[model samples]
Target: MNLFRLSKGFITEVHRLFALFWWESSDVEKRLHWGSWDKLCESKNDGGLGFCDLSLFNQAMLAKHCWRFIKWPNSLVVRVIKGRYFPTSDFLHATKCSSDSFVWKSFMWGRELIEAGSRWQIGNRSSTLIYEDRWIPRRHSFKVQSPRVLGRDAKVRLLLNTSAKEVEAILSIPTGSNLDDYLLWHFEKDGNYSLKSGYKLG
Candidate 1:
């Protein structure tokens, strides 16, 4: 489930089996379902059995692979995939190709979930785009809401007015150290992606 994308029918069948087990139904006799499957999948705090939604769980598992791509860009798998599918671009910006393999396609599918929950943490600011990337510390949509005055290629560093000390209040702080800008899972305090959070987000 983590490495491959399961079909909807397969997941449905698995859920059906799970339901039978939960209700203690045998092959000879069927038991009445006490509640809807949706309710059963809800959190225990919300009066549910807290059963894992297989489809969402599968997505969460796959999202972990995508998260790994971002967290470990230098890994062998990422390097090979980058060389083949996105030689000139990155995982976030890569588009699906007609000739892509099944495994790569599955990884891309996982990437969609990663996109929903991940955001950029500004450090060096060279990679953090001022408008396109999510860097602003806002509630929803961590992007610049103002009209664009800078070019599309403008980085967060470009917005910093390091030339004047007084302009610091109006702009983002300058690159304090040599740390590189990186992606973060905003749902976690440690800024790391976890299956539990990914499942909930899904």
Candidate 2:
């Protein structure tokens, strides 16, 4: 499940089996379900059994690999995957190919989770795309809220250094550092990914 994305049918069947097991139902007989499957899958605090949503769990599992790719970009495994899958681009911007392997596809699927929770921690080199990347450290979305204030290809450094009209929000962000900018897991205080956080985000 961590290495490959399971088909919906398979996950559905697993959910069915889980439901039957919890309800003490037999394979040959159907039983009355007291609550909807969704209700049963809710977190314990929400008053359900906190049963794992298999699809989301699977996605979370797969996302661990994606997290690894980002956290260890220079590792041998990441190097091999990048060389074959996204030689010119980073994992977040990699495009899909029809001929890509199932493992790569699963990794790509997992990348969505990372994309959702990731933000850039601006350093001296503010090369992040102003409209394309999330770096503003704001609630809701870190990307610029205004529509097309700057050129599509503009970088974040432009806002910090120049007198751009729509830069009040950008000006609030602190900049100028000695190190390179890096990705951060916005949900975690330590700026790292965890399976639990991934599952919630999933």
Candidate 3:
């Protein structure tokens, strides 16, 4: 007894590829309802049926790991985890990380999709990571008495090189820009940004 039957779409595709085998089967066994596919793919709790969506599940699990790396980039444990499971590619490589050497590639491939500004959530629940967005004016304390009055080009240069600590301080002023945009620009230009000790999550 075939307790579980294949979905109609799957059956149709299989039959197309194995027409000879299908044709040889009895006519009574070949019949299948089109509605059965949707029912079989629905969750058991929903009352329609029980079927696993392999592709969606894979994407969800990969997204979880992507969250992990962003939160703990410098952890020795993270490195070990990547090295053992994904040894060859860089941590941000765009390939899937099934083995020890592919972690970096996996991260690279999915990084943009799970960016800090994205509104994606875990398991269709609350937001996965908390973040704030703001724009900040550029300034150099040692060179200029009133850095905010500096020209746009000068401001950009100042903000780009300013340490995170200084940026945090200037951000406190009621200015045209906030810290969020400054951080985003810094990361975009430099490819890396440092988070203050308190800003890092455990």
1-202, model 1: which lDDT tens digit per residue? 8888899999888888999999999889999999988899999988998999988888889999888887888899899988998888878888998898988888888887888888788787778887788766543456666677788889987874323432433255335757898888878989899999999888
Per-candidate TM-score against the hidden true structure = 0.82, 0.88, 0.31
TM-score, structure 1 vs. true: 0.82
Task: Please list the C-alpha lDDT of all candidates, in the order they appear.
Answer: 0.81, 0.82, 0.39
lDDT of 3 by residue, 1-202 (tens): 0112234576556534444343454445664444454455566666755444433333334544565665576688778766754567544443453452444444443344344322211122121211221223232221222324434334232333444555554445343432332122122233232321101110
Comparing 1 and 2 by lDDT, which wins?
Answer: 2
Candidate 2 vs 3: which has more TM-score: 2
Those runs of model 2 whose alpha carbons end farther than 4 Å from true positions after fitting are: 160-174
Structure candidate 2, residue pairs in collision? none
Candidate 2 overall lDDT versus native:
0.82
**Which number leads on TM-score?**
2
Q: At residue 36, what lDDT does model 2 achieve?
A: 89
Better of 1 and 3 by lDDT: 1
Task: Write out the backbone clash pairs for model 1.
Answer: none
Question: How well does model 1 score by local distance difference test?
Answer: 0.81
Please tell me which predicted candidate would have the highest lDDT against the true structure: 2
